[model samples]
Target: MTDTRRGSIQRLDNIAVVVDDFEAAKAFFGELGLELEGEATVAGDSVDRLIGLTGVRSDIAMMRTPDGHARLELTKYHSPSPLAGDPQAPPNVLGAHRVMFAVKDIDDIVERLRPHGAELLGEVVQHENSYRLCYLRGPAGILVALAEQLG
Candidate 1:
């Protein structure tokens, strides 16, 4: 049998995070070092149908790392409202709960993000011959892991 494959996958465009405060979420990611790429409002039946929500309207902010290869989309739904979740949910709870980023200096980054209300979920720990990693609870209780490579 011959191998049959459709269009090849290009690259990951962005990760979407639904938040209650669009501007605050944008600022959180920005303080964490992601540059604001752009922001816009999305509506219409097509969007609603696509997201499986009726009368859905949202404001979205696109954030990108300095390298420009990675992106994060922060969205705030204005119609049909949004729901609240356990912000402090444990890691084992499942679903897409966290995003990890490689950083040059985890400690420094953590310090800088403190004023923005970024709290370390636990102490930063060094993994044997791999990395120094720590989980941070950022705006809206978004969990972000920071990894600094070891020499």
Candidate 2:
């Protein structure tokens, strides 16, 4: 092996998730603890340069973390077909997955989401590392995960 050293890695920057309704997804994530940072529009030119798209109108919502380091970017395209099959299923076939957030009160957060039409995909289970997590589907099948860090 080469005797070379690299600089230390820093904290996570951000992750992006595609949504059906920008406003609804923003509200859903806000209820889970993240705060809406702002929104942006990506014109067709930008989209084409990014992914060979002729035109694209997307609404982007930037959610800030409490610590102000990592962020969750939610993007909703104005024109796109709905996801097929069971939307609740993991997007393994499509190469996408849900983002899991660690929280202090997972149960309480899940309770708060009940009234807003959020549904749990599985029962919350306690793990060995003093953790508990539950899968949830938000508005428009937006996959979400709520986890409590007891350790």
Of the candidates shown, which would achieve the greatest lDDT relative to the real structure?
Answer: 1
The per-residue C-alpha lDDT of model 2 at residue 18 equals: 74
As for candidate 1, its clashing pairs are none
How do the residues 15-98 of candidate 1 rate in per-residue lDDT, one tens digit apiece? 988887677788788888899989899999999889898999899999999999999999898997888888878777868489
Every model's TM-score: 0.93, 0.81
The models' CA-based lDDT, in order, is 0.88, 0.77
Which stretches in model 1 have alpha-carbon errors above 4 Å? Answer: 1-4
Residue pairs in collision within model 2:
none
**Best model number under TM-score:** 1
**TM-score of model 1 relative to the true fold?**
0.93
lDDT of 2 by residue, 1-151 (tens): 4545586546677888777767777888888778888889876676767865666677788999787877999987774433454566664547657778888888888998887668988789988977898888877676778778886
